[model samples]
Target chain A: MSYALSTLWFERQRYLPAVLAVAFSCLLIALQCGLLLGLFSITSIPIDESSADIWVAHPDVPSVDLGIPIPEAWQSYLAVPEIAHTEPYIEGFAYWKKPTGGTELVLIIGARLGPDSIGAIRQLTPELRMLLSETSSAVIDEGEFTRLGIEKVGDTAEILGKRVRIVGTVSGLRSLAGPYLFCSLDTARKFLNPPPGQCTFILGKCHDKEDAPKVVERLKAHPRKLYPFTTQDFSFHSQMHWLTKTKAGIALGLAAALGLLVGAVVTSQTLYSATVASLKEYAVLRALGIPRWRMAMMVVSQAFWVGIAGIAFAIPTIFGIAFVGAEVGAKIMLPYWLLIFATSITLVMAMLSGLFALRSLRMVEPVTLLR
Target chain B: MRADGLPLTPSMKAWGLTRSYGSGDTKTYALRNVSLEIYPGQIALLMGPSGSGKSTLLAVLSGLLHPDAGTVLTLDKDLWAMNERQREAFRLEHFGFIFQGYNLFPALTAREQLEMILKWGTGCSARDATARTSDVLTMLGMSKKAHLRPMQLSGGEKQRVAIGRALIKQPNFVFADEPTAALDWKQGQHVIELLRAAAHDQGSTILVVAHDARIIPFVDRVLHLEDGILYEGEERPMELYGGPTAPSPGYIAQ
Candidate 1:
């Protein structure tokens, strides 16, 4: 065993605080970022739940939910060998007159209810699609009924003074800002009423999912100045828009920084005191003419080991907590890249703390060991 | 070669040495124009009262503390003339130190305690260090306890491990400051006997700083320090202690 590792093992009781502090920092950073990512993920639900491989939107569409009208004729722009099919998608926010005598803002999403359509969300079963085919019929998330001021799937509401009946409800499709009303294209047009022959976006399906980026690239040169994105790109763009608009990333950054600061301080102090406790033994080595760098290396090596140990403890706990969060309806996204990022930053913080603790080695004076 | 018919020569010679502490009205001298020579294959005991210049002299001679004036010429090099790095390198090559306390790392076993010196200081390979550490532990009668840490060993065993650390390099000079201060008389006597063997068997120059008068009979010569002044006591014959009879070296009168 290495001297540093042996020493750390023997004195693990003394170093526990540092290990725990590092673990806490890793946990806090990962969980907070995961929760924020999950929150922003909701903003891209329209793009994520669709079968479309590519989306063609207005030139300045920042997010799927915030899209502006584009001429439905632009669907022909996606006419390429890589594209298997195309359909017009209409979406806009409208105020619904609740039967309980109040008005609530709700997003109206309209798509072709055909089985071969690329714009309809996958949650719309054949029965629900057939029910939605009737004019002025809509489906919503079961959890949003309270927010929409409705009692059940058969309840009726008014959008723009036009009566609309809820056909059915789906699970796990809740929205962030407004309740989503999924309906047929004619029903949504009756409510949102974009200018004739215009839609919010034109979605395309590719023969091969990997060809979506190529198709999007080809559409980028269209004279109409269209915005084109693969489904994954569109999802990411939508989430990024909401993230920056809400300034939630800055809050996450501050929270993670605070965790790192606390971890650094505690870890630095722990290493400092441990080094000081061994000063006499180090002084003896110094008197025997061992170079100061050797001792410094040992301290830094201890810090490195502490970081590895802390990260080992944290990864499982992060996953476990994420699992619990999912069970309780709190979405926490622990993507592989996020895990790597959290651990990498945490390891760097620990190494910096090790450098900070090196100041204690200066107190080792060989002459003090005599007499 | 000397008038005493002894083939003696000094390996380390320090002259006109002076060291002081503090300054102004609070200034006090620890070594005042003191000089000494320690010969190879000889165990020289330096006895001094509290506040004497014993440890200061040891530090200066071992290249650990610098003297305010004068020079220490050891192994034919001016010890004080070398830069800090050079001095440290000089110590690593030729000097060994045993402070008053054991000062062994509590986490390492006895064998590891000695191997660390060769591995870290001399950069000796692991196999060589392990072999040398085994030999030293055997010599110290500590081979059986080589795997024990400081907490697991008795005080005397721990001190023996410390002594092994000092001798593991086979340094030309070994300077011990009150190595027996924390041991009982029997353990202290055993400690001095080990130092004697290093000087007599290994032909290393040994200088021990202690206040115990009981250690006088175990060493070949005794030197006393008082008020920063150094004094040489009468030397004894090597045959009396069954040690190798090296030529007698004369001391400079203080």
Candidate 2:
């Protein structure tokens, strides 16, 4: 065995606590970070699904959820030669009444009448589209059916205390804000009682996909009170908007931060104990003319091995939990960045723990071996 | 090259050394103004009743403990006068040690124990250390059991491995504190013979802190400690040790 590894092998059994701490830290950090990321991912879900090339919102809006309605006259934006068309959309929180007399929180998205464009309802069959054109017909996310106590399509559910029939199901769209309820503009206006020709903001498409950036740039400098962003930028801004502006966003972020802190503390403590337990052996190394820093490095190497094992154990576990989270509609998103981030944090924590644990090393007098 | 090509310097020397514990009336002397010299290429036994300062003298002469007063030198380099780091380096460079309990790392196999020592010695590479480890373990009769960790080794085997570690470095001095205290008379005699062989082969001096009389025959000189005082006593002739008489070992003059 190589020197560091050989030495670590001898001390391997004793470092279980440290390794376990790192594993648990990985789990905690990944879970919290995954939650925050999952939350952030969905924060932009509506914009991404809508597939609009550009979005116009009031300058003061922080997030998509909090944006003030831009004037409907902004429809003049479509006159720009590069502009394809525009769809006005609306979204708001709704009290989804269950058949059992319990109410669930849901966000509703109104796909204002236009092309098959500018809405999260990616594919609406002609029959479903014809059905959604009516004021009383809407599609519910299938994931929400369990919570609404409805078993199949054509079931009646209540929105805003009004009986509404679930005419279809929108697949593959979920929100950290819970399942979304989608409908036509007429239905949303009838249900939400908003003024005619006034919607939250205009969703604009470019004539060519490549024209989107130029349109966004030109529209940004356009003489309008409205703020213009590419749909991608708008989605990004919306996520950031909620992340910084709302209590839920802050809570999710705080939860992630708390996970990191707990992981660090627990891992550090375990590593420190492991180091102290090996002081006698380290002292022998010290006596053998190993410099203090080299001895410190021995502790680091031990922690590194433990950290490696912990990552091996943790990454799969996080992915598995994320997979399960998908089924339950609770977002646990472990992207590549989060995996790298959590692993880096855990390794650093283990190393710092080893360094902190070296405090007891000074007492390991080689002469003590004689005693 | 005489390991440096100089007139022989004493392996270790100490004069007017004093070390004690506690303070005021509680300050009991462990070694009181002890003066001593051990020379090259011989096993020198330190014998004394319990608490007669044998351990303290070993510690002081080996640079494990600092003396309150007086100078101690190993290989003509002043040990007590060096800074703490320098003294530690001096000890690592010049001495090998064995403790009463064997003091072997439980996780290390017998070969590793010796290799680790050799690796730490000045100018030794891993390859060279491994080679030296093989040689020394064989010399100490531990080659067959070199793969066994300390927990698997017998008490006598552990002691031999510790001896191997000390010998593998070819140090200027080997200090074995009660090296054979855990062994039977035959094993103890065998261990002493190994120490003697190392001295003869490497020209390194050996200082054994022990009370066993059976080991007396194998040593070149004997020092007795009493109430913190140390003094040289008569050496056993080679006949007494079942061999032809040989010249007595020389020492550096005080």
Candidate 3:
């Protein structure tokens, strides 16, 4: 074996407690961040899934939680010379009859199946177009189906007192605020109501993304008297609205911050304790002519092992929790970048603790070996 | 006569070495103006009572502890003038220490312990390091127990392993602090013989701070210490008879 590997192996048994602590701490942090990311994903599903480059809503629609009515004819108005396509979208919550003959709440979304349909919900599945074409068809996510005790694909669900046949299942496509049910505009209008010309919002797609802001400004100035926004602006406003107005969103943010802080402190303390415990060994090494930098490398190596082991132990458990959370109608999305960021944070915390432990190492006098 | 002078070549010399602990009225003088010389190829013992500065002198001589006021020259190099880093490297390159407790690294086997010294000494490849370790273990008659860790070995075996560590590096000098204190009479005699042979055959200077009378007979000269001053004694030849010798009456009195 190489010198480093051999020495590390000899010292490995003494560092078991520190390693276990690191693993458990990493697991805690990963699960916390994963669940939080999952929650954020659920809340932003409509915005994330929408194909619209611009959105037109009421001047103060607030968030996905609130709905504002606009003229459905605005779709034709937005389909101008510069605009490629436009569609009117209906979004609202309604009670649906469960497969078990009970009732559950879900967010209902309406969009046409055509060249101007925008395909926001269709992004959830390839079969969405086929399902929406059925006129009486509706698509519900797996999380909603599982919670409502619905197993078979053809099961019928009663929304707003009208029965709609389930034509397909969409996975991980639930709305941030509630379980989502996607259907044709006709079915949505029939259930949600004031006839053919009324809709909740207008979604417009442009030929060039750079033209989105100009298009939104033009639509806002139209005599139809509507509030319009670029998709990015609308998404940002939606997130901010939820963050400031909803108790669940605020609580989740607080919990995530607290979890990060506690994780850092706990990991640092554990690593520092391990260093102190091994102070004598470090002194012996110093007396044997090992430099301070080599001693630091050994400590850093220990920290690295801890961080890696902790992340490894945590990943599966986070996925399992996310699956369960999804079933309960909470959107738990695990983003790749977020996982990488959390691992980096864990390494930084471990290194910080190592710095503290180095103080104890420096205090060791080689002459103590004589005593 | 120049204190067994024979034209001292200053292989290891201390001048006006003094070390004191505490301050002012409460001060304790561990060593006061102590000076001595140990020539190469000599096994010298520092004999003293408790608190007589034997350990302090050894610490200074080995570059482990700096003296309050003195210059310790080993092979004409001033020890105290070197910085901590330099002193540590110097000690590793030129000095080998064997303490009373054997101080063997608990995680290492007998062979590994000796190999650690050789690796540091020669910076050689593993194959060469192993060869040197085996050679040294054979010389110390510890080849059979080379695979055993300190915890698995008897006190005598552990001390023998320590001797192997000290001698494996082939340093210019070796400092031993009560090396045979933990061993029985036969084992103690064996350790003293090993030290004597290391000096005679390897031409290395050996200095030991010991109160054990069992080791006195094996030393080439015993320097008696009353307070911290060295009082030179007559040179004595080592008596390596087979059986255990009874403890000295003076030690029994203490």
Candidate 4:
């Protein structure tokens, strides 16, 4: 065995407490962050999956929830040579009639279902296409279906005083702040029936993503006065608007930050205490001709192993939490990149703590071992 | 005095060594112009009163402490003039140490302790180090307790394990500070014989600092010290009992 491995093995018993502490802290941070990211994904599923490269709305459209109505003529104006296609989308809330004749409020989104449809609902699940193909068919997010106790396919529900059929269930398309229901444009317009020629927003897709900025600028200068945003800009605005304007988003973000800070502090303190407790052993090792850098390596290696163990423990714990949440009709989705990010953060925190704690080794004098 | 006059061949030499701790009026002298030569294949015992510099002299000779005003040459290389890293490497490669309490790592068994020393001090591979550790433990009569931790062994067994650890690398010299101070008469005698056999049979130089006096007869030469001054050769046998009869001065009977 190498010197580091031998030294670690020799002192494995002494280091176990510190390793467990760090691992537990990492698990807490990963689970907290994972839950928060999962919630954020649920909130933005519609916007993230939109086919439009740009969105045109009235000035200062509050959010997707509070979309402002614009002239349907704006769609034709936005369909310039630079733009590939443009379509109008409507968003509103409606009371859905349960199979038992009870009623529940849900957020409703309306879009074309053909090739030109933004296909936000279909992006959630391929099965949604079959549901949207029928004129009166509507797709309800799995969370909404469970919350309202609507089980069988082919069940009919009343949306905004209009009858609609529940043809399919889409996964991960629910909004925690509100239930989500998806239906085609014609059915939605018949239900909403705003004054003739008005829609919530006009969504435009460009031939190339690179052409998005130009299309947005051209639409912004249209004679009718509209606010245009590229898809990326619109997504950012929506996310920031929710984070800054809503209490739920702010509370979740703050809780996540606190979890990260607590994890870092707990891990760092545990490592420091372990180092102090083993100071004499470190002196003996130094006296035996182990280099300072090698001593530092021992601490860092211990931290690294602890971090790995914590992640190993955390993966299953997070999945369990998500599963439990799903059983109760809560929408929780863990993205792959979020887990990767959490692990990276955990490892970096561990390394930083190791570096800080190993500084104690430098103060050790070999002569102290003689005493 | 030099070892040239005697038939013994010297392995470590100290010339006019001096060391003091602290500074100004509070300065305390731990060693004062002390000089001694320890020869190969012999055990040298350092006897002294409390605060008489036996530990300081051992530290200087072993390169664990730098002498304030003198030279310590081990195997003909000046120890104090070397940098810290160089001195550490030199000590690891050439010196072995046995402290009073054995100082074995609590987490490791006796065999692991020996193997660690061999692996670190000699850069030996794991298999070779383990083999060497087993051989040394067997030679030291500690093979049965090889897997036991220090706490599991009796006082004498622990000391034997410590001896095995010290000799695992087969260094040229061994420096021990009061190896038997914590042992009873029987255990102390066994430890002394173990050190003697290690020096004679293994051709290694052994230097021990102690005031125990019980193990003095087994040593090849005795260097006595008083108030940081060294006196070569043995003192008058009566003078050995001049102070308190305990192992160390001020050490109350328990």
Candidate 5:
């Protein structure tokens, strides 16, 4: 074992605060970001819970729910052999005149009700699809009944003065900005009343899902001004739109930065005091002609080991807390990339803390040991 | 004469050394025009009362502290003439130190304390460091306790580990400042014997600073300092034996 590690292990009590501080930083960064990701993930539900491999929409379309109407004829633009199927999808926000006399905004998501449809969400089972086939029939989230001011399936509500009846309900498909109203493309066309022969988006399915990007890139080269994104990319793009537009990313970033600052302070101070405690011993080494950088390396390596130990302590705790949050109906998304990002930044903060702690080494003058 | 039938020369020579602290009215001298020579294969004890110039002179000679005035020539190089980096390199190559307290790191084992110097200072391979550490531990009579940390060892054993750390590199010069001050007479004697062996057996120059007069019989020569002045002797001057008057200038022990 390295001298630094041995010292850290032997004096673990002395270094525990720094370790816990680092763990706290990692935990805060990861959990805050995870919670935010989970919260914003609802914004991309239309893109995520669909069979489409690629979504081709108007250039101005910012998010799935806020898409602009594009010519349905754009389906011909994706007529490559890689694209096996294509269909028009419609989504827009409209006020639902609840029967109880209050208006709640609802996003109307419309797609083909076919068994092998590319644009319909996977949650629309054959039975729900048959129900949605009825004119002006819609599917609502079971959890959003209170928000929509309705009690159960088959409840009648009016959208833009047109009467609509909820045919079924699905679990866990709740929206962030507004509750989702799932229905057939014709029903969405009647409610939204876009220009005839135009649709909100044109979604396509590739023979092999991995070929979606290549197909999108090919469609991008065409003269038409359109936006094409693979399903995963579209989901991320929609989530990022909401994240930045709502400024939640900035809030979470500041919280994570504050966590890093706390970790740095505690870690730097801990290393500084530990070095001070060993000042006399280091003075002896300095007197023996050992280079000061060698001692600096020892302190920095100790910081590195402290970072590793803290990360080791944090990863499992993050998953545990996230699990608990999930059980309590609070979604906390801990993706692999977010975990890597949180850990890497926290480790860098630890190393920089080590650098900050090096100022204490200047006090190690061998002349003081003589007295 | 050396064992090889060659004449011996001073391994370290310093002349006209002076150092002080504070400035102007608060200025006080720690060393004044102190001069000395230490030869290889010799253990010299530097004895003085509190505030004498012993440690100051030791610091100056060891290239640890810059003297206000004077030059120390060791191994044919001016010790203070080199820049800070060069001087530090020189010290790494040739200097070893033992201070009043056993300054071993509390977490490292006795063997690690000694091996750290070899590995970090000399960048020696781990295999070679372990070998040298084993040999030094054996010489210090600390091989059995090499696995123990400072807290696990007795005071004398800890001091022995410090001694082992100093001698591990087989340095040309070993400067010890009250190495035995924390040990009983028996342990202190053993510490002195280790330094003596390092000098006589390994041909290293050893300079020890201490207050205990009992150490007189163990070293080859004795030097006394009083109020920034230095004096050399085969033994301590009689003035230090409770004589009435202080030893005059140029006083030498008979």
Candidate 6:
């Protein structure tokens, strides 16, 4: 080991608090960044789960929420040379009457009972799909059974003043707003009372996924009151709609950034104080004729070791938090891109704090050793 | 006294060394019009009471501190004429220092302490430095305790290790600030004798600053400082048992 490294070992007590501070900062940073990424991921789920390439919605509808339902005749879009097929889906929000007679808020969605239907419900097994073809049949996520007071698949509930029966349960479908209750288009139209022969979205399959841009352009040129978006384009716009127009999205994003900012400040202050305390040792080296750069390398070495150790500690901690979040139907997803980004941010923060700590080293004069 | 022995060539010389802290009426002078010459192959003692600028003079002469208005020369190279980088290189090439409290690195074992100095002062590889460290430690009577850290060693052992650090590079000169202050009489005398032998054997100039007169019977020349100025008293070499056993290594007859 270099003298720089050995010095840290000798002074471990003097440097322990700073090391832990950086570790805690890493945890908070990963937590916030991971949460933001997960939020963005789930926002795209409605788009990602779809097999269709083209989505038609209200010209200004940025998110999944429906605008005034449009006429269902948009199926004529399939007749376009670039288009293959189309399906209409209904989406809205309503109150769910619990068994206790109290109402809870819910997002309600409806689509045709076919594999080619417009919604992204993974729970619609062949059996469930046949069952959902019957009116008054619906499905709810299995994870929320306790929260909703439902004991089994045959449990009944009331949505929008219409009696509904849960026929099946699905996994991996969750929303931050509340639980989702999926039913048929006919049932949705009869209960929520949207205009007859109308749907909030028109999903279109393209002959070739690559040709979607051309299809969207052609559909746009033909005079129709609807907007055309590739599934990706629609997903992005939907997420942006929520992010730009709603306070919840903006607040969560700010909170994530705030966590990173606060972590850096706390860790930087702690490391800076530790560097100040070691100035005397640094001065002794300087007086002994060690170069100023060598002394700086000493401080940088300490910071580097601290950063590595902090990251080691933060990985398991963040994984535990994510696991706990999953149990409550809240997902704290950490995709590979987020992991790489967080790791880079961690090293930069550590190096920046190291540089900040160097500010105190400049004050260490060789003359201090004389005293 | 000089007729008996005075160097025709000196290792270091300073003229009008003046240093002060603060400014305006509140300013206090640590050194004023101080001038002196240091000779080779001899341990010289500097004595003074508190706040008399004994340590300040040592700092200025050794290139550890810059005087407000003065000039210092070692081996005829102007210590202040060079920039900070050059001054640093000059100190590494020419000077070694032992502080009163032993100022040894608390983390480094006894051998590693000397190895740190040897490697940095000479640009040698760690293996080579470690090799030399064992030889240097043995020379200082510290071979058995080379692996112990400063805190694990006693006061005298620490002082001897400090002396070993000063001697490792065979520097052009060594400045020790109160080398014997922390030791008892026997340890103090032993440390002084070690420094004396190193000076006699290596021909390196050694200057020690202290207030303890108990160390006086062991040095070659004694100088007194009172209020930032040297007393310029008569120069006399201390009587010794059979005199300096070995001729100074780099000495030329005057």
The most accurate candidate by lDDT is: 5
Q: What global local distance difference test value does model 2 have?
A: 0.74
- State every prediction's TM-score relative to the real structure: 0.91, 0.79, 0.69, 0.71, 0.96, 0.74
Model 1, range A108-198, lDDT digits (tens) per residue?
9999999998889999999999999999999999999898888998999899989999989998899998999999999989998899999
Q: What C-alpha lDDT, on a 0 to 100 scale, does residue A123 get in candidate 2?
A: 59
Instruction: Give the poorly placed runs of model 2, Cα more than 4 Å off.
Output: A2-4, A7-13, A35-43, A53-59, A70-108, A112-120, A134-138, A141-181, A185-280, A323-331, B1-8, B118-125, B141-144, B234-254
lDDT of 3 by residue, A40-72 (tens): 555556766778888888776987546677777
Displacement of residue B58 (Cα, Å) in model 2 is 1.3
For residues A246-275, what per-residue lDDT tens digits would candidate 2 score against the true structure? 666567556656755665566567666755
Which model scores highest in DockQ?
A: 5
Q: Rank the candidates by TM-score, best first.
A: 5, 1, 2, 6, 4, 3
lDDT over C-alpha atoms for residue A79 of model 3: 74
C-alpha local distance difference test of each model: 0.89, 0.74, 0.72, 0.73, 0.91, 0.74
lDDT of 4 at A31: 62
Would you list the clashing residue pairs of candidate 1?
none
| Docking verdict class for candidate 3 | incorrect
Error of 1 at B143 (Å): 2.4
A149-168: candidate 5 lDDT, tens digit per residue? 88988789999899999999
If ranked by lDDT, best first, what sequence of candidates would result?
5, 1, 6, 2, 4, 3
* lDDT by residue for model 6 (A235-337), tens: 7677666655656566765665665565556556766776676676566557667787775666677677767766777788888998998887555767666
lDDT of 5 by residue, B110-163 (tens): 999999999999999999999989888988888899899999999999999988
Candidate number that wins on DockQ, 4 or 5 = 5
lDDT over C-alpha atoms for residue A60 of model 3: 69
Q: Which window of ten consecutive residues has the lowest lDDT sum in model 3 chain A?
A: A1-10
- Chain A superposition TM-score per model: 0.94, 0.74, 0.61, 0.65, 0.98, 0.72
Alpha-carbon shift of residue A294 in model 1 (angstroms) = 1.1
